[model samples]
Target: MIDALTVALGVTALLLAAWCGFAAYRDQPTKDWHFIGMAVVALLAVVQLVIGVVRLAGGDDPQQGVAIFVAYLIGSALAVPIAAFMSLTERTRWGSATVSAAAVVLAVLEVRLYDIWGGVGG
Candidate 1:
């Protein structure tokens, strides 16, 4: 995986989390701008996923193990989309909370992924 891209994704996730957290704190629902931010994060995740898979296919393996790395990749890629769907269902401040939570989770997952790549255990 590309180190800079992974760092970018992790930072983006935190930023998204902060944005949604602020919205929830203000008693607001997930707004169009939040959705756009989510989309951008998700797009980054997808790109990472593709790159990871291609690298794997080309015989590059993570230090931790392929299974765990791929799992994190897929999970990170799906996190925002699932959260966005759940947010759409609620249409309340709680919806923003859900997105915020997901964003935080994604950030943590990205960090974990980096650790795994470097053979560090959680």
Candidate 2:
């Protein structure tokens, strides 16, 4: 896996979490700008998923095993969009909280992805 891309995804997810968390704390729903941020994170995840698949096809194997790695890739790509959809249905501070939680989950997944691929270099 690409270390830089992994780090980028993780950092971006954390930023999104902080943004949405602040909004939730302010008792606000997810705004259009928040959705824009979600879109950015989702796009990055999709790109990462594609790159992971390509690497796998090229005979690069993840340390933890292929099935789990691909599962994580798919989950990472889906997490934000799923949370966003859930938030859209509620239209309250809880919605923002939901997104914030998803972002944190995505960040954790990113770290796990790095470990699964046997990331070594800093």
Candidate 3:
């Protein structure tokens, strides 16, 4: 697993979380800008997913079990999109809250992904 890429994803997720949280605190609904942030995070997640799959296919086994690792990869990749869709259902501060929650969740998942990869330099 690439530690740098993992760290990048985590940091981006956290930033997005902070943005959404600020919007929510201001009682603003989710905006196009927020969706753009989600798209960026989702793109990074997709890249990470592809890299993980290729690495695994090339016989680089994760220290953790394959099922768990792959599960994290897929879940991380889908999280932002799922949250965005849910946000679309509400047009209030709650929508921003949903996105903020999703971003935080993605960050947590990234950390777990790192652990599942057996940590940096593993």
Candidate 4:
């Protein structure tokens, strides 16, 4: 993984997590901005996944981290959209809160991604 791009994705993840956390605590509706943020994060994740696969094909060792990293990637990619749709079904603050929780998951996955590459990341 490219260090700088991973850093950028991580920063985005952090912001998303904070926003989601606040939304959950306040029992607020999930905002469009939240969806937008998730979409952007997803887009970045797609790029990261591509890079990862390319590196793997190029013989960049995963150092035993590949399985978890790939799993995290799939989880991170699915979380936002799936949660958003599920949240919409309930129309309650708790439904929205599910989305917030998903955001946190996505953010945490980014950290895992960094560590998977054996970077001095957290």
Go through the candidates in order and give each one's C-alpha lDDT: 0.92, 0.95, 0.92, 0.73
Model 3 off-target regions past 4 Å? none
Worst ten-residue run, lDDT, model 4?
A: 113-122
Residue 39's C-alpha lDDT in candidate 3? 96
Ranking 3 against 4 by TM-score, winner = 3
Candidate 1 per-residue lDDT over residues 56-99, each given as its tens digit: 89887688899999999999999999999999999999999999
Pairs that collide in candidate 2 are none
Candidate 1: C-alpha lDDT? 0.92
lDDT of 3 by residue, 4-121 (tens): 8899999999999999999999999999999999999999999999999888898887888889999999999999999999989988999999999999999999999998988857
Query: Which residue window of length 10 is worst by lDDT in model 2?
Result: 113-122
Candidate No. with top lDDT: 2
Between candidates 1 and 2, the TM-score winner = 2
Q: What is the C-alpha RMSD of each candidate to the true structure, in Å?
A: 2.7, 1.4, 1.1, 2.7
Task: Give the winner by TM-score.
Answer: 2
Of 1 and 4, the candidate ranking higher by lDDT: 1
Number of clashing pairs per prediction, in order: 0, 0, 0, 0
Query: Each model's TM-score?
Result: 0.95, 0.96, 0.96, 0.80
- Tell me the tens digit of each residue's lDDT in model 4 across 2-73: 656677877886777677668778877777777787788778877877777787778776644777767766
Q: In model 4, how many backbone clashes occur?
A: 0
Q: Alpha-carbon error at 78 in model 1, in Å?
A: 0.5
* Model 4 spans > 4 angstroms off: 120-122
